[model samples]
Target: MKINHVAGARRLAIPLAIAALTLGACGGSSDGGGDSSDSSSDPSKFSINLDDCNDPDSATAPIKGTFDVGYSAPLSGPVAGAVELATAGYDARIAAENAKGGIDGVKVKVTYKDDAFQPDKAKANGTEFIESQKVDALATFGTGPLSAMVDDQNAACTPMLYPSSSTDAYVDVKQFPWTTTILPLAKNEAKFLVNLIKDRFPDGAKIGIAENQTASGKVQSEAFQAAAKAADLKITEVASDADPVAAATTLKAKGVEVVYHGGVTGTCGAFDTARGRIGYEPKLVLKPSNCVNAVEYVAAGKAADGVELGAFGKDPNAPENKDDAGVKEYLAQMKEAGVPDDVIGNAVAVSGWTQADLLINTLKQAASSDDGLTRLSVMEAAREQDYASPMLINGIKWFSQPDLLTGIDGFRPIKWNAADKRFVPAGDVISIRP
Candidate 1:
């Protein structure tokens, strides 16, 4: 319910102090030893006894072992498009990891059930994940309509589930223990929008927020409003219409200068037309969710222009992503596997992949010791530190966010160039150094 932009470095970082991250707690050593010479001196270290595949001395092994991760998403529901995109991202990520010899040479087992984009299903899957499958932890579990399962995850005492949903309430780590987000927090995006508006628009500029009536959209709208007010900007109105483009046209006619909208890719495109219709140009800030692939949002040439959006996560097309540790490799694997590269890049798949990536690392750490290889160990690993994925916000490394109850709420403020059909970071995000 809030949209504004501000710039600053990350204030809090995961305590990297030795005390905060106990060497034996996760059973792995974060400190890099002197050299391979010393490791070779103890031939026993080469016996392939540890869980960390990061061991450079030996060849990464294949999936001789088995562990499970679960997913809760809408395979059938209204937001199925978004859910599908995320699922594809997950599958591609899995295929890539498996192709390169799974974590610790053990293949990861991903099991999933569709929540039909329904909350009941999400809750149900959460229970199953914690009790039955006994997975190391949940990964990229789409909240769908579930809002969240922080209490459920905590009640089940599960480890962090790298979540893709963005509910600002979960920013607090003290509450939710079993999930992390990849996108910059929605509140942060809102804050970012504020700065953008002040710098772009002049005095007496009318700003309005038109968002989908969903809880997420409403939350974004409010956050935008609060930030706008803090910056001494005036909000023209808040419209609950389900259609963004139509609503955008009406709001523009009402003399709106900046429009903040929370809608799907389709609705956001309509906002583009609203600008031309009114003959008055207004800066448009879209919810980060709509900032992704223009394949859908900007279908026709020149349909979407001057659209300011909030990206809740990484830009799939960033050049820096080329050198990302595993990106090229993932793309190669997907290509060889005959899976559509686009499928792998889909939002759902990205969330799934993000979830899988963090879980794999946690599993390695949890399995470090012979005695503590239970779900509890994995849970602890999820809590101990943040997972820095290649596609996360600039400064923020996502661990299990305890706030939003689910893994949603991770987002960044990004802008879209209708000409290029790409997402670029609109402003700086505050977080730890990668």
Candidate 2:
């Protein structure tokens, strides 16, 4: 899971000094806002004016000009893997926008700060981006990185979109006015799996869930519990453990029929260990980002065959998904940029492409100021655009359905193959009602 960003981490200290507070100039522009004659080859073709597009409940009109976009990422730290995904997304966006001659002819600049996944650092970074950077809006933000300000974003009226990690705090649409998620929540994902299992594997409808004793595990537990109740399916004991092996041992003793284990692909063998011990097995439905890298997880000898995972988009290497617009471009760029195939599969690029496209839509409707960009204008511009994210192989749409402010509410059922060591589409997308 090495993100490969240590080449020049020494320079981060300088930016760290300049970006001490959350406010400053990062010099960027509104994305995808210029001549239609440029590189249309990129699948994310963003039009200049959004007049033809449908904008439902466009809260206000857009104000364009030197719009500021603030970013808070790991930039340099231990939790660098998560930040690496976020960085890749941010880079793709800035590159795309710069290629388009800048948003609304005014180039977008991002003020990025490094908090290394530390809350105090995150708070300082947020303040630096807002006060010093004077950003009119935000894009590709991390839910886990700056999670504390969930309430602050609502109070400030600063709209934001996520690259990954959709915490429950932001999922409640009513509580947060400015934040939106691009991934399906745990509850939505579990609900989709429950219904899919009922239709696909109805014969043995028992659920055995083993959750990791982590923040992620708790979130997953909430979703699985709710889904089990809704489907009227019986959920076996909820075992909490940091040791996957122990969890497997417990499940084996329970004679579990269906198992939902909460852990990364690198460590899902607990299910197999339990199967070996009990000499019995059941189907599995993991988190959306749970078992993405087939070559990594399956190659490690995990029993991936017939196991289902919830996530957006399909593997780029998968022949069926290669022809797709988003999939093809992401794979190509990742390779050209020297990013490994395994990292590309992280869905970081997809997160960027989705938000970058939406931001272009926002810029087209921005209201320009007499001298520069303003919060009122940016917010208004955001309201004028109709967000239409690219369709993922999974049942989820990158953008919300009816409500423009909502987050990504769709997911796909991916089946893992022990033989091929990859995830294949099990069924259609499960769309969650917001």
Candidate 3:
């Protein structure tokens, strides 16, 4: 695995390329005079013969169709704020692409439904996308919801593009051919986090981990234990629960010098609150997930100030990224979509935006056919590309290989500036090879 600064122009031709793709692959005559057989074979000449509804207000009227992709995520719940921000990224990217004339010639529309982070709801939404919406594909945030709907997705053969889960089981290529997890696995991420801690702190420094009791959290804890053993760092405390403040307090009592949080954004807030209460601040290291809603931690005031976080791309709120082409475009698009600057800065939003970016790029490659693209073709195309998303950190590109299930293997570390409500570069992007 190799990591470098993400440096490149925002890909401008993706929309144009998708629009320019026609039925030329069908061998239709270039000249006005064409063979009857060739003319009949042209897919462009065929009309979409959808039946019309008699009721004017029925809303089932026949109209020109656009490319429909389904997105199911928790819109309202404990993690609602984070989920909304992630969807905002998806919305911003879709608006930008549409303004550029959409994917090829068809405008892309996301049929969104809130799953409320429930597995059953996610499965139901998956069925709707397959049976009713007849979507070309599906995209989601979080691994649990994605895992819940995997069987349905596989049965329907509708590609599940980018689910925001770093769980290894969710990304098993052989088991879930219809699914693709874009981000690095949590285990790999844990290794990177440990490496950063070891490099920054002394070998004998007391380190602590605060995480949820969920499956992903357990995996993260296990990975941390292994990495800690290799790094020769002492793990003084381990906390698992909804509230991370208790864990923080325990670590503080043990005189832990550093703390790494492997839980939700709100848990980060809990840590901040606990630290504020105890008036003890250890060097806090958070994963990118915690940084997604930095403002949440901001409410805890200086407790979370100067916290360092991991990053797979340029920090969305970093002032230094203001001039970056990709950052400029993202900000502009997010603004146009009416997303507030604060929410746009969420790291989760960056995740959703990059996911859509990768899917579109892969679609462009897969849709180069006489009959247009299918879900299968898109999945196949995805496996073929070494994808470089504009939202990724400078110098690193996600490459899908034959033997590897995960596409990303590196990330940079970032620090949160409470005064500016932004994340600035804390260190260079580093690769974590398996």
Candidate 4:
């Protein structure tokens, strides 16, 4: 999970500092000229007019300058395995895009920061990118960190896209017009999980739910309850941040036939360990948030066997996807980027690639539009584009549906095979409505 900044990072940092200083010279003087409600206090002071594509050539004219983007995620934390793999995915995707002469000739430059999964740090990083760096858009990971940056996003008027959080709050079309998600909503995931459970355990299995004590976790908790009720499953108990062993023991004693873990992947690991120790193996279904292809978790030896995981993309190691063009490209890019083999299957890495794919495609659409290169135009393009990538689920297309702000509506079911050390498709891609 070590990042090799050495000289490449320094080269990127210098230009960003210079650009921020140059942009700031005109940004602060808007005290008298513009409306206070807009993201930019003084839109009139922009160095380059975003309304007109400076290139008079054509709709597909090569862009004249660099397209600035910001990225913030946990690079050092409990979820670093996921974050770091995702970060590499972003880098690999960007490299592929840039190699193709970039989007409409404007090379994208990302100012990446590590938020350490801290709310305050996430906000600070978001502020620095939007206000100081003056980036066109910001990409974030995780619900907690994304929530922390909402105010910063509105203030800067910079569009924030591809937040991996499935929380409904992130998709408020009215409140956060500048924000949209790339993943399915948590409630939608809940519905899909419940459907699977109903079909598998037709007799109405007794279920126990466990979640974190955080705000996002609470939202997931409620979604699970509603879904469980819809499926007519009996609820034995619900625990928040309780000792995994104790909780598992209680649920086992109560004859709970299944356990739904609604927290981080670590929580899932804890529950599995507890279940193994107690010799009670119930059907474990994880919310998409906790469902991932973490290397260590996969290597844990039978802890995750038969554990059903919901995700929006194909497994990196899936035999069917191995020869697919997109998966091959992704693997090649990761190898070229020096991504470690052990961390390649992390699900967040797929998310990172999806994020990059959306960003590049949206920028291309915006750059080629009648109203070109403006932040507003980019947001509009993001909302309008029916983007798809090689790595997304077989039938899923990014923003394929017009009504959904979060482009993805479906997820595939994957099961961990501890003996084989890989994830195999558990079922077909399942789409759920909001």
Measured by lDDT, the strongest candidate is 4
Cα TM-score per model: 0.71, 0.70, 0.79, 0.81
Tens-digit lDDT string for candidate 3 (98-136): 889876776778888998778788889988988888777
- Root-mean-square deviation of each candidate, in angstroms? 11.4, 13.6, 11.4, 10.8
lDDT computed for candidate 4: 0.67
Q: How many backbone clashes are present in model 2?
A: 38
Query: What lDDT would each prediction earn against the true structure?
Result: 0.54, 0.53, 0.66, 0.67
- List, residue by residue over 394-429, the lDDT tens digit for candidate 2: 444444421233355566667777776667777666
How would you encode candidate 4's per-residue C-alpha lDDT over 266-352 as one tens digit per residue? Answer: 344666666677887776645554457556455546766877767777668777877788888788887887887766666767778
| lDDT over C-alpha atoms for residue 200 of model 4 | 85
RMSD of 2: 13.6
Largest TM-score belongs to which candidate? 4
Pairwise lDDT winner, candidates 1 and 2: 1
* Order of quality (lDDT): 4, 3, 1, 2
